[model samples]
Target: MPILGEFREFIARGNVIDLAVGVIIGAAFNDIVKSLVDQVVMPPVGLLFSGIDFARLEWVLKPDNPATKANELVAIQYGAFLNTLIKFLIVSWVVFLLVKAVNVIRRRDAQHPEATSSAPPPQEALLMEIRDLLKAQAGREEPPTRH
Candidate 1:
């Protein structure tokens, strides 16, 4: 099909592959940010909050009936939400910093390359005019020689 050929062309262009790689790296980085939040950041936060362990912290929306532990699910996982929120913020900050740094370097490279080089001016019009004048002069000389 024409569509399949077009899709193949699109995939073969390398942009899709680059995007796939970026997604894979982003997923891996997410785990790193999660670890940083749970392991490093939350401990100090827990100490600040009178030694409350974030993981062990949760609020029960529906209290389980003392008589039965059946069908007693609850809601509002604030601690996990809080921890995840912190992780998101850290990841966003890191991504922002990375993008900012990349932009700065890109701007710098655009302004000043390793060795700045200038392009020569185009001389097509001038060359064409000179060529026409030479041909005209040759035509005039040939007529005089005939006379």
Candidate 2:
């Protein structure tokens, strides 16, 4: 019972909830970026490179076994490695763009907050009224009025 209560308290924390949400969203974002790279970026680039198959790019680490066919020999997947590197770069660029967009939105919101339509809080209004009254009283009670 004590352990369950502690676990419940920990799970209810704002930071923990936020972190869990971030992880879920981040995974979804990674999938979108991967799809964009594979579908949008790689095809055009591959076409530009004389229709080269990026994934098939490789360096034979061991001598080719012509007897067992090319499929039988072990080869280092340098092309696939290159493809992965390109995918990494694309994902990073996309994440950078997303962060930049978020920053721009934050800046815009800071400049023009949506809540500007609301009136000042009651406490602030009271403080302002008190300040104005004090200024008026000071003017009325100056030396000419007091002497």
Candidate 3:
């Protein structure tokens, strides 16, 4: 029961939930990217290469033998690999752009720190209150007033 409770607590963590959501979204995004590569992007590229279908591009290592019990063709599918490589490049480029945009926004925020938030962080506000209390206790300043 304790182990179960611990497991429940672990699953309830914000980061765990966020990770789960990220994985689900990532899987869906991968499907979208795959479809984009296989259906939309590859066709035009294939056309440029004289009607060559990238998915069907392969090197036959061992041709299928009808006499064998298992008549299976062994081949290295390089065309599919090319399509996957393109998908990877597209995904990486998009991620790079998103990170760049986020960095720009963060840089802007850092340049104008006061505009980022109206209130100080909780720790800063608490420390300020403590400083005011100490000054008042030492008879060096007037008592703090609430805003």
Candidate 4:
């Protein structure tokens, strides 16, 4: 097949479509999680810690001076790191729960095969029967082999 045809075939695959959808949904979910962490979760937690704003929490290595010719405020932003860490933990926890739920569902399906049986369809079963009958007939009609 030509390269364009092969590319079209690849793009038409179910897994590729599924992956595209997953990426789009994941991006949206990331935004939601970020909002939840930055706005909803952090504000309440900050209130608990004496109104400490994590995003602004930093260790100042060099304080800004107005008199110096080259004055710059250098700091390590540990508070922002803490906020990011919390967001990571939250996202990981949610993913863990989702995976756990999926695993439980898979286990249940596995334990009860009758619930989601993969037995051959009627047409396939009939084709298999015909194949077996042809094989038997072919064997019976074969000439006897010389010793």
After superposing candidate 2, which stretches have Cα over 4 Å from the reference? 63-72, 108-147
Q: Number of the top candidate by TM-score?
A: 3
Model 1 stretches astray by more than 4 angstroms: 1-3, 69-71, 114-147
The CA lDDT of each predicted structure is: 0.86, 0.84, 0.94, 0.94
* TM-scores, each model vs. reference: 0.70, 0.62, 0.74, 0.71
Write candidate 4's Cα lDDT for 1-147 as tens digits. Answer: 999999999999999999999999988988988999999999999999999999999999999998988869999999999988988898899999999999999999999989888879999999999999999999989688999
lDDT of 1: 0.86
* Candidate 1 per-residue C-alpha lDDT over 1-147 given as tens digits, one digit per residue, 9 for 90 to 100: 699999999888888999989999999999899889999999999999999988776777888777886978586778898898898899889999999999998898888986445543469767888899999988878454453
Candidates 1 and 4 compared: the better one by TM-score is 4
Error of 4 at 30 (Å): 0.8
TM-score, candidate number 1: 0.70
lDDT of 3 by residue, 9-111 (tens): 9999999999999999989989999999999999999999999999999999999999989969999999989999999999998889999999999999999
